[model samples]
Target chain A: MSEFDLIRRSQEVICAPGARYRAQCVLGIGDDGAVLELPPERQVVVCTDTLVEGVHFPLDTGPAAVGHKALAVNLSDLAAMGAEPAWFFLALTLPAAAPAWLEPFAQGMARLASAASIWLAGGDVAAGPLNVCITALGLVDKGRALTRSGARPGDLVAISGRPGAAAHALALLQAGRVPDARELAALEFPQPRLELGLALRGLATACIDLSDGLLADLGHILEASGAGAELELGRLPCAESLAGLPEPERWRLQLAGGDDYELCFTLPAARAGELDALQRRCGLELTVIGRITAQAGLTLRAPDGSPYRAERAGFDHFGGYRGEGSPAAS
Target chain B: MSEFDLIRRSQEVICAPGARYRAQCVLGIGDDGAVLELPPERQVVVCTDTLVEGVHFPLDTGPAAVGHKALAVNLSDLAAMGAEPAWFFLALTLPAAAPAWLEPFAQGMARLASAASIWLAGGDVAAGPLNVCITALGLVDKGRALTRSGARPGDLVAISGRPGAAAHALALLQAGRVPDARELAALEFPQPRLELGLALRGLATACIDLSDGLLADLGHILEASGAGAELELGRLPCAESLAGLPEPERWRLQLAGGDDYELCFTLPAARAGELDALQRRCGLELTVIGRITAQAGLTLRAPDGSPYRAERAGFDHFGGYRGEGSPAAS
Candidate 1:
C-alpha cells in the first residue's frame, strides 16, 4: 500500500465505533490537521515517546506488539500525569511499506486505542528505518494533574501492579530461553494503568510510570520533589515467574530492569486506607513498597532491615551499560 | 550526556523566554507530560510531520535548517487549517549524542518557536538514524477553522507567497549549482504563513498548503470539496530566478515542484476585495491564480489558451520520483 493508503486504513482501524474521543474531535484524519474541542474546565496534557527498532524493541518482534507497546508507553506517561487518554498523533517510519506488517500493526494500535478511548487524530508515515513516535494528549481537571514534583517527606510510596516481569522476559529472551506465557505477555503487551491513574488523580501527591524500573523512575519523583525514598525490597511485588530466581537476580530485575509500565506514586500516610479501598474497588493490586524520605538519596531496605546496594539504577541509553544481557534497551 | 541530561539541556534550549505559549502551559518541561490550559472558547488543532535524513533533506543539510524545517512543516499545516500555532512536541532521533548537532538543532527550533510563540512542551530523544518528528498544536475559535472540503463553484483560488521557489532551489542544488541567497533562504527557511492563516480564518472557503506541489495539493482541496479547478498558468507568480529558466522548466517548477510551504485557498468571488485588504494589512502577497469549477479534474491553461500538461503532479515518497533532480524532496 502507498503511504496515503496505509494512513487511511490505519485511521479506519484506530477510530472504530464507541471511541470516546469522537465527541472531543471536531476533525480527524485526512486534513492538514485535526481539530479537537477542549471540554469546558478541562486542561490538556501532552506527552511524546519514540520507539526505535533494535533499540526499543527486538527486530523480530511482531508488528502488532510493536504498535501496541508504542501507544501503551505514551499512555503510561499520560497515566503518570493523571490524565485521561483523549487523542494521539503518530509518526511512523518504516523500512518498506509491507502490508503484512502494517495491517497487524494497525490492528494492535487500534485495539489499545479503542480500549483507552483515544482516537487517532493525525499522523505522518514515511520510508525509513522502523520508528514509531506517538504524541498523546489527555485531559484533566484544572490543577488536578499529578506531577512528579509533588512528593513530600513521610508520604507513602506505592506501586500499582507488579514490576520487572517485562525485564525478566527480555532477559530470558536474550539468553535464548523462552519465557512462560505470563512473562511473554508482560514483555509483548504490558497494560498501561489508565484506570488506576485516573483514580489517583486527586488522591496521589506525586506519580511516575516505571518505564525505567522502579528505582530509576522513583528517583525522578524524588529528584523532582527534592526528596528521597526508602524502598522496602521485601515488599516489592515481583512477578510469579521471578520467584524462582535467586534473591540478588530477582532484585536486579525488580529494581533496575526496565519497561514495567506500572505506576509508582506517592500519597500522604493518612490516605493508605483509602488506597487499599481503591485497590479493592478497581480489583488491581496496589502495594505500598516504600516511603518518601527526608534524605536526598535513594535507600533500599532488605527484609532483614539492612541497606541494600544495587549494581545499577536502571537502563541509560547513552550510559556505559549496553544491552549485553538484556533483550532490547532504549 | 546521559539521556536525562540531554533532556534537561534540550528543555533549557527550547524553553527560552518570550514564549507566548507559556501563558497556556500549566507546566512545561521536566514533567512526565506538559499540562496546558485550553483558552475558554478555543478548540485545539494538531498536526504532525516527520523529516528523515536524505528523504526530507540533503544528507549534508545543516542541523539547524533540518530542525527548523521539521517544525516549520507542521506549522504550515496549522497555517493551512487557519489555526494559531501554540505549542509543539518533538521526537528527535539521532545516530549518536553529538552536541554539535543537538545544540544547533535546538537553537534553530527554538528560534522559530520563539518567533512563532510556540513552546516546546515535551519530547523524547533516542539513538537511531537522524529523524525529527514534530506534532504542533494550535487554537481556533469554535467552527472557525478552515478545511479543504469547503470550496464551491466560482470561488476564486489564491495562493499566499510564491510557490516552487524552494523546489527550484533544490533542483539547482542537486545539479551542483549554488543557489542564490533568496533561493537558499526559500529552501532552508520557508516561513509558514501564520498571520495570513489566522486572518483568513473566517474569510477563506477552503485552504491547503503547497507541500506536495501546487497541482497535487490543490487537487486535495478539489477532491475534498467534490469540485475541480482551472488554473491560469500565466497568473502563477514565478520567482525572479525561475523566470530566467525555459518556459517548460519554469512551469514545471511552479506546477509540479514540492516543498513550498505556501497556502493555497479558495474564497467567494465577492470576497476578493476583502482578501486584497487582508494582503495589504498583513503585508503578504495573496495572488489569484485560478477558479474552482463544477468539473471533477484540475486543468491548466496556458497564456495562449492552450492546455498545459505537467510531467507529474508532485513528489511522492513511494512513487517513481526519487528526488532525481531535487536536493530536498519531502
Candidate 2:
C-alpha cells in the first residue's frame, strides 16, 4: 500500500465511535493536528511512547507489527488510568521513504486501530532514522483518574490477562531456539490488554500496565504505594507456550520476561466478588498472584514453600545492564 | 543536579499557573503522565515532533536550548491552528545517563513551558542515541480549527514574525561564520508566534508554521486549499540581523533557510482593517508578502520587478537529500 493508501485503510479502522469525552472532540485525524472541544471540566489524559528502530525492535521487523505496537503501547497507558481513548498524533521518521515499508506497516496499524476503535487523527512524517512517536489522548471523568500511588496495605494484588509470554518469546528468539508458528506469532505480535484495563476501573486500587518484567514493574507499584507484597511464583499466569519448555526455564521466563502488556493491579479483598463478576463478563482470566503486605519489599515464594530466588533481573533500557541469560552481543 | 532536581527546576519554569493548560491539569511533572480534567467539550488538538542528535541539533548544543527548541517546535503546530496549548508529554532517549546534560535541558524546557503557560504532564527517559519527542495537547473551539486547506485565489498572503534567521544561523554555525551575539541568539532560540495565531482567527484564510522554509511550507497550504498565489519576493520580511550581510546572501538565507517558527498565512484583502487593528493591539509587525492568484503555482518577483529565479531549497528530513550549500558529509 502507498502512504496515502495506508492512511486511508487505517483511517477506516480509527473512525469508530463509542465512549465520548465531555469535551467533544470536533475533528480528529486527517489533519495537521487532532482538534478537541474543551468543556468546563477541561481534563484530558495524554500519554506518549517512542519506539526506536533497533532498541524497540529488531532492524528487520515488519512494518505492520511496528505500526500496531506503536499505538497499542500508548493505549495500554490510557487503560492504566481508566481513561477512554479519544484521539492520537503520530510523529514518524524513516531513513528513507520506502512505500513498501509504509504500506504494510500502516495496514497492520489500521487493523489494530479499527479493532480498538481508535482514530488515526493527525501527525507528521519525515525522513530520518526510523523512529515512531505516538501520543494518545484519552478522557476520564473529573477527579476519577486511577494513579500508581493509591494502593493500600492489605489490598489484593491481581493481574488481568496472561503474562510472561512476550518475554519468553523474546528469549526463545534470542536463544535461536525456534518455536512453532503460534509461539513465534506471540513473540512478534503481543497484544495489549486494553479491555482488561478498562474493566478494572473500580476493581483495582492501584494499577499499571506491565511493560517491563513482572518483578521490575511490580516494584514500581510497591515503591509508589509505599507497601510490599509476597507473590506465589507458581500462581503466575504464564502463557501455555511455555508448557514445552523445561520447568526451570519456564519459571525464569515467567519471572523475568518483559513486554507482558498485562495489567497488574491491587484492590481491597472485599472486591473479590466484583473482580470475579467483571472477569466473567469480560471472558478474561484473573490470577491472584500476590497480596499487599505491611512489609516494604517484594518476596517470591516457590511451590515447595521456599522463597523463590532464581536471580532474575529486570529489563534494561540502557546497554551494558544485562539481565540473566541475555544473549551476548556478537 | 540530580535527575529529580532537574525535574523540579524545569517544572518551576514550564508548568506555572500562567502556562497555557494549568487550570485543568490535576497532575503535572513528577508523575508517570500528566492528568488533566477532560472538560465536557469533546474536542482537542494534538501534535508531536522529534529532535535527533546531530540531525536536528549539534551534539554540543546546550541542554536548555535543546529542551526549549523541542517544546517550542511542537507548540508552533498548535499555534498554527489557533489552539491553546494545555498539556505536553515527552519521550527522551540519551546515549548515557548524565545529570549534567539533563539539568540545563530540563531547566530550558521548563522555562519555555512556563512562559507558554502550558503544563509538563508526563514523559519517559531511556538510554540510546540522543533523541527527544515532545507531544503537545491543545484545546480549540469545536469546528473552529484553522486548517491549511482554506485559502482562496483572492486571498492576501500575510505572515506573522520574521523568517529565515534560523536558516542563516545554521549556515553560520556550519561555516564557523558566527555573527554577533544578537544574531546568535536568534539562531539558538526562535520564538513561536502563538498570540498572533489566536488574533488571526477571523482574518487568515489559511495558516501554517514556517518549519520547512517558507516556499515549501506555503506549498502545503496551497496544495491543501487548492489555490495558488504570486509572492512579491521583495516584500518578504528579514530579521535586522541579516541587514549587515550582502544583499544576495541575505536573500538566500531569507528564502531558503528553515526553523523560523513564524506563521505564514493567507488572509482575504477585505480583512485589511482587522489585520491593521491586530497589529496595533499586539505590537507585532504584520506584512503583506504576496497575493493569492487563480494561477496553479507560486511565482517570485525581484525588487526590480523582474522574475526572480534562485535556489530556494528547504530542509528535508532525509540525510543529504537536499543538502544545498551546507558542508556535505564525507
Candidate 3:
C-alpha cells in the first residue's frame, strides 16, 4: 500500500467514532493537525516518549506489542502525573509500509485506546528504521496535578501494582526462556494505572512511574522534592513469577528492573488510611514500602533494620554514576 | 555526559525563562510531563513529525539544522491549520549523547522557539539511531481553524513564499554540488509561514503545507475537499535560485520537490482580495497559482492555455501512483 493508503487504513482502524475520548477532539486524524478543547479550569498534561526497535524491543517482537507499548509508556507518564488520558499523537517510522505489520499495530493501539478512552489525534509516518514516538495529552483539574516535587518529609512512599514484572519478563525472553502467560502479558501489554492516578490527584504528595527501575525513578522524586527515602527491602512487592526465584534474584528484579509501568507515589501519614479504600475501590494492589525523610539521599533498609547497599542504581541510558544503594545492578 | 547530565544541559539551553511562550507552560523539563493551560474559548491544535538522520537530513547535516527542521516541519503543519504556534514536545533519539551535538541542536531549537514564541514542553531521550520527533501545539479561535476539506469551486489556490527552494537545495546537495548560501539556508532552516497562516484563518477555504512538493501536497487539499484544481504554470512561484536551472529541472523542483515548508491555501473568489493586502502587510510572496474546480481531478494549464503533463506526482515514500502533470521526474 502507498503511504497515504497505509495512513488511511491505520486511521480507519484506530479512529472509530463514538469512542469516549472522541468528544474532546474537535478534529482528528485527517486534518493538518488535531484540534482539542479542554473544559474550562482544567490544565493539559503532555508527555512524549520514543521507542526504537532494537533498543526498546526485541526484533522479533510483534508489531501489536510494539504499538501497544509505545502508547502504554506515554500513558504511564500521564498516570504518574495524576492526569486522565485523553488524546495522543503518533509519529511512526517504518522501513516500509507493510500492511501485515500496520494492521495488527493499529488494532493493538485501538484496543488500548478504547479501554483508556484516549483518541489517536494526529501523526506523521516516514520511511526510516522502525521507531514509534508518541506524545500523549491528558487533563487534570487546575492545580490538582501530581508532581515529583510535592513529596514532604514523613510522607509514606507507596507503589501500585507489581513492579519489575516486565523487566523480569524481558530478561527471561533474552535468556531464551518461555515465560508464563502472565509474564508475557506483563511484558507486552502492561497496563497504566490511570484510575489510581486520578484518585491520587488530591491525595498523593508526589508520584512517578516505574520505567527506569524503582530505585532510580524514585531517586528522581527525591531529587526533585529535596527529600530522602528509606525503602524497606522486605516490603518491596515482587511479581508472582519471581516468587520462585532466589532472594537475591528477586531483590534485583524488584529494585533494578525497568518497564514495570507501575505508579510509585507518596502519601502523608494522615492519608495513609486511604490506601486500603483506594486499593479495594480500584481493584489494584497498593503497597507501602518506604518513607520520605528530611535527609537528602536514598537508603535501602533490610528487614534486620540495617542499611543495605547495592552495586549500582537504576538503568541509565548513558551509564552514569549510580546513587548509593541504587538497585541499578542486576 | 551521562543521560541525566545531558538532559539537564539541554533543559538549561532550551528552557531559559522570560521566553514569551514559557508562560503558557506551567511546569516543564524536569517533570515526567509538561503542564499547559489554554485560555477559554480557544482550541488546541496539535501535529507531530519525525526526522530520521539519513532519510530527512544528510548524515553530515549539522545538529542545529536537524533540530530546526524537526520543529519547523511540525510548525508548518500548525501553519497549515491556521493556528498560532504555542508549544512543542521533543523526543530525541541518539546513538550517543554527544554534548557537541546536543548543545548545537538545543541551541537551534531554542532560537526557533524563541522566534515563534513556542515553548519546549516535555520529552524523552533514549539511545538509538539518531532521530528527532517533534509534536507541536498551537491554538486557534473556536470554529475558525483552516482545513483541507473546506475548498469550493471557484476558490483561488494560492501559495505563500517560494514553494520549491528547499527541494531544489536538496537536489543540489544530493548531486555533491555546493549550493548558494540562500539555497542552503532554505534547506536547513526553512521558516514556517505562521503569520500568513494566522491571517488566513477565516479567509482561506482550504490550506496545506507543501512538504511533499506542490502538486502532491496540493492534491491532498483537492482530494479532501472533493474538488479539482487547474494550475496556471506561469503563475506558480519559483525560487530565484532556480532561475538558472533548465526549464524541466525548474518545473520538477517546483512541482515534485518536497520539504518546502511553504503554505498552499485556497481563497474563495469573494475573499481573494485579502491576499494582496496580507502579502503587503506580512512582506511575504503570495501568488495565485490555480483555481479550485468542480471537476474531480487535478489538471495543469500552460501559459498558452493548453494541457500539460508530467512523468510523476510528488515525492512518495511508497512510490505509488502520481497524479498526472506532477513534475516528479528530474
Best by lDDT: 1
Give the per-residue lDDT digits (tens) of candidate 1, residues B201-269. Answer: 878999999998888888888878989888999999978888788888898888888798999999999
> A43-139, model 1: which lDDT tens digit per residue?
9999999999988888799999999999999999999998999899999999887889898999999899988988888899988889999999999
| Separate clash counts for every candidate | 0, 38, 1
Ranking according to lDDT, highest score first: 1, 3, 2
lDDT of 2 by residue, B1-330 (tens): 323333455456455566645666786654334688755543567777788877777667888899889988888888888887778887887766576777688778877787788777777665567788888877765667778888998889888777777777777788877656766666667787778877777678788888877776776787777767777778888788777887678777776677888888888888766777888887878888998777667777888888765464465554332433211110
Residue A60 of model 2: what lDDT? 67
Candidate 2 stretches greater than 4 Å from native: A1-25, A28-32, A38-43, A244-249, A310-313, A319-330, B1-20, B28-33, B39-42, B244-249, B274-277, B318-330
Query: Which is better, 1 or 3, measured by TM-score?
Result: 3
Candidate 1: misplaced stretches above 4 Å? Answer: A320-330, B320-330
**lDDT (CA) per prediction:** 0.87, 0.72, 0.85
Q: Count clashing residue pairs in model 2.
A: 38
**CA lDDT, candidate 1, residue A223:** 82
Off by over 4 Å in 3: A16-18, A320-330, B16-18, B320-330
Assess the local accuracy of residue B6 in candidate 3 as a C-alpha lDDT between 0 and 100: 79
lDDT score for residue B55 of model 2? 76
> Which predicted model would earn the best TM-score?
3
Tell me the deviation in Å of residue B195 in model 1: 1.0
